[model samples]
Structure formats: C-alpha cells, structure tokens
Target: MEDSPRSQELLSLEAIYPDAELDITSYSGTITISIHSADPVGISFAAVPNTQPLYDSINYLPPLKFFFQLPETYPDTPPTVALLSLWLPEATLTALHASLLLIWDDFRDMVVFLMVDHLQEQAFVLFGLDPPIALTEVQFEFFVSYNREQLQEEFDTQSFTCEICQQYKKGKSCLRIELCRHIFCKACLLEYFSTCITAGDIEKVHCPDYECTKRVAEERKRMADPKTFITSGTSTRDMILRVVFTPPLSLDFLSFLPPEIVTRFQTLFTRDQYEFFKSNFPNRAVNCPVEACGHGIIRDDVNDDLVVCPKCRYAFCIHCTNSWHGKSMCRLAVRLDIPEDVLEQYLSYPELSKDRRDLEDYYGKFKLRRAADAWHMDVLFKEMMANELMTACPSCGVVSAKMDGCNKMTCHLCKTPFCYLCGEFLDRARPYDHFNDPVSECYRRLFEGMLGTEEELMRPIAPGFAL
Candidate 1:
C-alpha cells in the first residue's frame, strides 16, 4: 500500500526535525525552527515611556513553533498553519502566517520546508525592521532569558576539548568562563581554583588558559591607573574596596567549587584589592574608627578630616580616628591615663602567662584590660598618623602633613625650608637643591611614597605632639 501525500509530507518533516512531535496516523505535528544570523543582532528594550532603551547584542532568538494539520487534499489544498512564539508580537505572527499562506499559494507543493527555510534566513530582518529590534521591557527580558537557555541547552548537548586537561568531554561535564568563554572540565577547574584559593593565590583564580590569562593581564595593564597600584600594607579600607571591586571569579563558574573554597577566594581577592587601594591612596583612604566596623572610606576633600564610613555610617575625624568633631581641633592627645610602666609591664608578658595573670589580678582584670585596649588603640593611632599622615618640621619642630605636592616642605611656624622625606633643613636659597643632589638620599625620589613609587614615606613622626 502506498502512503498518502499528507502522510508523506508528515514523514518527511519528521525526518527533518527528529525532535519535533508528530502523529503519523493523524497527520498533525508541531515543529520549531531556530533563528540564526551571521552577525550578532541588536535588541533594545524601553522599560518606560520617554526613557532611552537598554541595549544588548545576541546571535540567537527564541525558536518559532509551527503547528500544522495536513488536510486530506494535502499539497493541492495546503496544510493549515498556525505560528506561535513567546517573544514575537501578535501582529508579527499574523504577518508570518500570511507569508506562509503566500508561500503555499505560489509553490502549490510541499511548502513546509520552504516556510522553515524562509523563516530561518529572514528572521533577523523580518518585516524590514532594522537592526536593534525594539521590544517592551517584559518581552526583552523574556527573549534574552529564552535565548540564553537555548544556547546553554545547545552547548550541553555537544562535546568539547578542555584546555586544562587536554581531554574531550561532554559540555555537561565542563565549565565555561563567562568573561573569556574558555572551557575546562568542571573537575579540573574545581581542583585548580580550589588549590589557588586555599593557598591564598587569588590572582590565579582567573582563567587558566595561558593565552586567555595573558590577554586579560594585558587588558588590565592597559587599563591600569594610579588607583590600581596596591601597597604591601594591609588595612580595613583595603579589604572593603577589594570586596566591592575585585571579585575572585565569575559567579557562574564559582558554583563548581566547594562553598568553602568560594568563600576563601572571595576573602583573598578582597584582601588583595584592599591592600592595593590602601597603598596607592593612603592620604585619601582611611579606616572607619568603629571597633566593629572598620570599613574603608576614601575622601573627596583633602582638607576635610571628616569621614563617613559607608559600611557602618559612622562619621568620624580622620586625624583623630574618633567621633566626628566638626570644625574643632582634633583631641587626639587625650589618653586613658594608665601608668606607662604598668602598661609596659602588662604588655611584655605573654597573654596566657602567669606574669600577665598576676598583673591582671593586681590591676583588676576588667580595668586593666580596658586600659590596655585604650593604650593599644592610642599607639596604633599614633603609628598610622606618623607613617601616613603627618611630618615634623626640622627647624621649629612643628608637626604637619602635606595633602599633596613635591618633597620640599616649609615650616608654617618658623618659615624654615626642609625636605619632607628626611625632615632635614634645606638650603634657604635652593630648597629643591637638596632633592636635586644625587648624593642626597631624597634625590630623584620626590614622588616616593606616592602611588607608583616603591619607597615608603620617610617623614619623621614625633612620639608625642600636641593638637
């Protein structure tokens, strides 16, 4: 027995689209045709009226489904076709339906294949709409998500060679880095990144492919500015900026790693970024004074000592590291009044030693610990101020800090010239001669302790100063 024309058409479609659902007996089925373009197509979405549209580029769109029932008359009578899509407008669907009917009317033969071919080729330019198909916010979101899902699905069904292991693997067993689109087996990525995170090598957490890493590094170097340089010293501000700016790896690939490893990666990456920001912008960056909230705060006004921590909203004076004292002299000279000798002796003993215990008992543990904490904080405050903030004038012994400029400094009180780096008195007639002299340690090091220089600031910070 020979098959009917309708059955033959259905069989041919079934062969072409193996995944399509078809009923040979009923001569009815649904088939999906994916839209593809040689170049990426632009899509724009207007979230609200009178606003510019958000734009994105993609190479794929959601598949268009064709539902058909072959009539007994078949090619002579054309199959009934209905077009359906998640993202296409109703009017576009109606137009597509009319186009399919025209194709059948002109061909008067098996036109399903022709319709599918026309859709595949013309989808991007359908209705003569130019690039950047305009869509509503909801439709845009739906199309993007659907497109991504389709791409992922397609990837998962294929096989690739992982560069890391040099082994062929199914896409489901591999992980793709979103930034570089490099693929590696999940097991290899897990082991390699986990080791890096555990060893505190946050920089190695990026794509392991040599060419990819080199390209990324070159790009980063090209984008490098003074702000990207990190110093050796670590601080609370450094950590905060790191956490905010430099994530360890893309979150998509991080899922392949253990939770602990992911956490470690984040910690190390943040710490690294924090160190860089702290090193490059010492004067502009200060740690929040709150004991429990030491977030980094970068200042906009160099003269204003007032700082408000973004993390804790604790407003404080940068110089005093105390609660904000608006328009008033910093009261940093105030101390906890613990006897120096007692505080020294208490600190010399090991924390758990009997000597420390005996001192704790004699001074009363709570009182002694409180005094010790205050003393330690004062010492830290002094160190930070000296190392990063202020320098004492060599002639009058007046303490001051330069917001920015060359190494040559002048005493505001005595009007004596000096070198800010070594605090040595400069020749009155030739103050810069000190730095220009090759024999002088400060020679050619005027910018030392600034963003790019390797040398630390050399200003002498007095042990005691009145504010």
Candidate 2:
C-alpha cells in the first residue's frame, strides 16, 4: 500500500528518534520519550531550596511521555501535541501545548523533529514550574503556580554525591543546612556531632564552614572577647555562607540519632536554655556549683538572696554569686578575665601577642587599689538590684536603669528591648500594657521617676493593634 503523508512523516520521526515507540492507530500515533536527553535550555527547580542541587546526576529523572496527533494535511500543518504527565497541573500541560504551537506556527510546515527537540529541551521550563507569578483571577493559573512547588519535592528524592566524605547518598540520608545548604551525609554528620558533643563543644555545634574554622587562629588574635565577637574582621559573611547557630536538623529529626547521642545533645541544649533563663530571670532558678549536685534551686521570692542547694545542701549567696558569709561581708566581684587564647580566637588574629609585664607595670602604678571588701560591697549592690530594682538583658547583660520611660527598654548596644523588671523582651508593639495589668510582675511601676510624664506612662494600648 502506498504510504499516506502522515505515515511517511511518522516514519521520518521514528528514524530520528529510534527509542520513541509509536502506537499507530487508525486515527493517530503516540511517540514516547522515556529517557534522559540533554536539555541545557531548561531550568531545573524554581527557587533553589534549602538543599543542594543533586550534582552530576542523570540516572533518576522521570521520563517524558507525550502524544502527537497528525492532521490530514501532513506536511502543510503542525501536529496537535498533548503531554501525559498526569501529576502536572492542566495549565502546565496547556501552557506547554501553547509553547509547542508557537514553534509549530514559526514553521507552519513539516516541523515534527523541530517540535520534538523543543519539547525535549524546553518542556521543564515551559511547564509553569518557575516560581509562580501570581495571577489571582484565573483559578487554573493560580493552581498551576501552587502545584509547581511540588516539583522540588520530587527532585529531592533522587540521589546525589555528598560533598563531605565524597560519597553518593540518597537524598533522604543527607542533611542540608538551611542558609548554607551544604549537603552532609548521615554517617559523617552523626560522627562529627558525636565527637563535638562528647567534648562539650555545645555552642560550637554549627555548619562546618571550613573558612571560619581555618580562620579561628587569626580570629583569636584580633579580639579580646571570643563570646561577644559578632562580625569577623577577616572571614566575611560570604566565606562562612551563613554564620548562625541554628542546627541543620530540627528536633523532629533527632530520632535519626541514637538515644545516647540524643541524651548528650539534650544535656547541652537544656543547659543553654537554663543559662538563658538564669541571665534573664536571676532570682527564678539559681544554678548550684557543687559538683554532681545536678540541680537548680527555685527562688520563689525576689528578696531571697541566699540559695540552699536542695540536693547538695550547699548554701550560696545570690549577690556575691559565691559561698555564703553570714555576718562577714562577701568579697568583691571582679570582671571575668578573658584568657589570651580566647582573646586571640575572638580577634581572628592568632599571631598577636602583648608584653604582659610591661602592661602590668603600666597599669599597676596608675591604678590605686580599693579596699579588698569591694566584692563584698558589690554583693550588697547585687542583692538590692535583684530583689527590688532591675533585670539584665540576656544578650548584652546590660542592667536595667529605667527611671521614667515605659517599662519596655531597649539595650543601646544590642537594640533588644527588654522589661526592666522581668528582663524579658517586650512585644515591640504593646510594650506599655505589660505593666498596666495588676497580675504583671512590674505592674504600676512604669514611671520609675526618670523621664516620661504621667500621661505617656499611663497611655493605654488601643484595641486590635499595638503601636
């Protein structure tokens, strides 16, 4: 039988795409491309998520199955295109069809191979998979955009080589830090975290950005205070990708770790939370220093300066933060002396050195020593501050000295506004209301007789909104 033009065109297509299997029915034929092909033109996932792109991977992308129906006027008109990826929103399929049509219209004749290559190369991008531009009126457009995000989830399930340990791993077995998005396999991360936790490097549990790690020596030499150093002079933010304290994995994923590891992690995490509370709420729970006593004594009253460790039966004074001296004065409190190593580490300038004897000689003669009872006086001062007057900012340790402004006060250095009485951060909006209520800890004490007038201090928060 003499071949129809459509059949002849189908034969040409089959010749070009040998793997494309054709289902030749009386009405139409469908050619399926069920394998990977080079599509440098196509965009992958829309917004690169908090995960690395599966690198040097080609074995796992799903196949592209499509249908093409020929018109009676074979070489004179374009074939009708239909995609069969059912999970794709209809608008995506429709948008794809429209894109193909544009290519078909450009030729308007015998463009089968051209159309197929376009489909292979551009289908991923044209499928409405980019971050959606909002189009609210048309529900189909909105859904197509909403559903496009699912493509990332599908892409994540594939396997990729973890940069650390240089091993291929399934996506599920890898953890990606949010801001940095560095991929670390399960075994490598668990091992590293185990070693760090065992050594009590709790606060240092962070993304192992090597630049920051390598610069630790230099960072040390440049700063005196390691704990308070915010911006590194040498290692800029980009070198670290993200300089933050958030762990790569959430508490929900803690089950992936062994129970022993979990316990160790919880020990450090609990200590951090306790320290946070202690700094902000000094009289709430006092940490006892006796080794293995392992308990916090609750301070029910603001005036309670003496803490008796319930477990160890060791008594300590809150003001001096030391062993109790009943009638004898508590010794003076000295500023915490930062060690040289810690200073160098904070400065990121490990090579720096100072002439200690020269500095000692210079400072020693200029400064006259006060009475040895200075710490004793500080103890009494602390007792009054904790019991009657103020709280300190947890971040900067700035003491509350509000005389007149609203109960909410912002730390000048850290800019963290906290309550003078509770030392808790005030809601940025309705700060004044915190003291107005009768049940509040600092109630009716908004005006500490320093700055604001009676009306400003007593101004009530408006309904539904805070200023």
Candidate 3:
C-alpha cells in the first residue's frame, strides 16, 4: 500500500531535517531550525542601561524548535504546532506560533518546509521586532553561547584550505583567529606559535597572515592616535580607558596553542609590555626588586619615592628598591665590589703598560676600563681609608663617607642616604626598619662595626629599642 499524504510529508520533513526527531506512526515530530542573518545581528541587555550594545557581528542566533502533530486529515486541516526557544520570550514564541499557523492557512498543502524557511529567514526581523534585540542578561548570555556553538558546529562540518599548509582540511583540524578571522590548520598554527614563543619573539606570535598582521598594526596605530577617537566623537578619557583595559591582540588567539606554550607566551608578553613601559617612561617606571615577581611599576608621585608593586603587593622605595621606610632617609645602594686599590692600580699604569695589559687579560678589558673611569674622580679627592669607609649612592653613584654617626650615610652630591656598613639602599621614611626586621641579614647589626664614644652606636639595636 502506498503511503498516505501525511506519511509522505513526514518522510519529506525527515529528509529535510535529518537530525530532527520524528514519530512516523503517530505523525508527530520536532524540527530545530537555525536562524541565520545575512548581516550580523546586534545583542543588547535590557538590564544594562546606558552602555553600548554588544556588537559582536553575530551571524547565528539560537535555534527555534518546532513541535508539530499532523491531524488525521492534515492537508484539509491546519497542523497543531508550537514554537519553543530558550532565548526568545514566551510572547515572541506565541507570536511565532501564530505566524506558523497563518502560513498553514495560506499554503494548506506541505507547509512545514515553507514554515521552516520563513523562520530561518525572518525570525530576527519578524513580528515588529528588528535588529539590536534587547534581552535580559541571562537570555543574552544563552543566545551568545548558543550562537557560538552553532557556528562551531557549522564550521566543523565544512572544509577549508589552510593558508599556511595550502591543503584542504576539516574545520576541526583548523583554528580561526578570533581577531582577524584568519583560518589556519591546527598543526601549522601550533608549530608556528610554539617556535615564536620558544624563541622569545613575542611580537611575532600574532596572526601569521601578513595582511592580517598589517591590518592589526594599522588598527593599533589608529587607536594610539587621540585624533582618531576625537573624530569619532569618543572622549579622551574613554580612549585612554580602552587602550589601558584592552588586552594585546596576541592574547586573543591563545586558545589555539598548547597550555605550556600559552603560559610561556603570557610571560614573554608581560615582559615585553614591561620593557615597552620602561622605555617610554624611564624616570616614572621602577623595576620591582622581588626576584620572582619583577614586574615594572609606574610611579605616581615623583617626590614620594614609595612604590607598591600591583602584581606582588611589595611596598618598596623607588630610590632604594627596598622595603618602604616610614620617615627615614634613603641609604646609598651602590655596590663597589671591586677593591678601590685594584681599580687605582689598574688606572695608574700607562694606557699600553704590560702590567695593565696583563690585568686586562685576566679581567675583561672593558670591565676594568669602566670601573677605573667610574671611580677615577672620587678616588682623586678622598683618602684610601675614607674611600674604604665611603659608599656610593645607588641613584647618582656619588661617594659618601660616614664620619661619626649611624650606619645610615647620606650622599653629599645627590643626598641619597645609605647604609655605610653594607651599602644597601635605605628608605628615607624608616631607614632603621631595615635593621629591626628579624629576617633581614643586617638586622641588629646596624652598630656592629662601630666603636669609640658614640653613645648612639653603644645603644642596643633591637626590636622596639630606639637608637
């Protein structure tokens, strides 16, 4: 026996939506139709007022599932149908359901295909609703996630030729950079990005496509210019905030890389940013002294030398690069490790003396030359005993000797205070705190080398004991 018209329609619907769930005996089925827009649709949240709508240029929206049952005399009678959607409101679904029924009234024969087509094409714009769809926050999130999943699903089924390998591959074996939308095979991208990161070429770790890289550079140039934002009516404050908050483009494609590579890329990227910052603002930027966390910190106040590293929460003086001192003077931190006698002896010999040449051969010629030049003027003025007692300021490199006071000696030239015993930089705010901290190597040794009738030096340098 030949199938009935309803059975024929069910078979046709099954053919049209291979993934749809259908009950052939009962003549009932559910077909999910994906809504695609020619132009990217805008999504906005009604909960977030006054903010710019998120314009991700989303081409796919959450799908609408059509649940329908064919009546016994389906061609003559309208089909019973309902629209269900996770993102769309109940009122919109109800309107869509009515629209589906109206289509059945107009084309009573084989209306499922026509209904599906109408929904696919007009769902975003139908029923007096247009683009920039305003939804609740939860709905908006669901829509975005659903759209991304659908897009990935579609992409995974398609075939594309990777520009790098010049070979056709399925989307599952490829990666599409989110910023530039340039596609490359996963193997090619992984190898290329891994090499760049391993070589510390962090700047070259972005999109490998030359055109995309150039376009990104141009975009960055445009963003850097204040006039670009001004011409577009964006406030300078907004432009600054955007530049400061926006992550680098290299970070956008990290999903394509392995976890270890991603970590290395992040570390290199941070170091690159720190170098760039230091180059641009030499005086204002200070390097954190913490060996493990050497992030660059930008100083807000020039007069106040205290700097707190944002990444490590380490509070140190900018001049001394040590723990923040409450009110004590900053101590000289210059390391005069090479003996002044050795440096003077090296300088005493003629430029071509065999003795100097021998010393230069033992030590690097450049090293001895630089050391001699650095201490030449200071050695000429101060005596040998005074030179041994003196410590140079870490900031200005000027030598200052301690005569009869505490270990904290301030440079006469640059006025930078330093510990005379160890030449460690002292914070101007609370210089004695360095000696008071139990973990410090110089703790309680502030007056260790001092002798004679200095009452302050004889005083105990302990916790809570004022010197």
Residue-level lDDT of model 1, residues 351-435, one tens digit each, is 8997787555334454467668778776876785666457788767787776556777888899998888788898998888887
User: Order the candidates by TM-score, highest first — what do you get?
Assistant: 1, 3, 2
Which one wins by TM-score: 2 or 3?
3
For candidate 3, the lDDT comes to: 0.71
User: Stretches of candidate 1 above 4 Å error?
Assistant: 124-127, 215-224, 227-244, 298-304, 327-467
- Cα lDDT tens digits for candidate 3, 405-466: 56767788777767776777889998898889898787886775465546545655433223
How does residue 334 of candidate 1 score in lDDT?
Answer: 35
As for TM-score, the candidate ahead, 1 or 2, is 1
- RMSD in Å for all candidates: 19.0, 23.0, 18.6
TM-score of each: 0.63, 0.36, 0.60
Q: Which regions of candidate 3 fall more than 4 Å away from where they truly are?
A: 46-55, 106-110, 124-128, 213-252, 290-293, 299-306, 317-467
**Which of the two, 2 or 3, has more lDDT?**
3
Candidate 2 has its poorest 10 consecutive residues by lDDT at 363-372
Q: How high is the lDDT of residue 130 in model 2?
A: 42
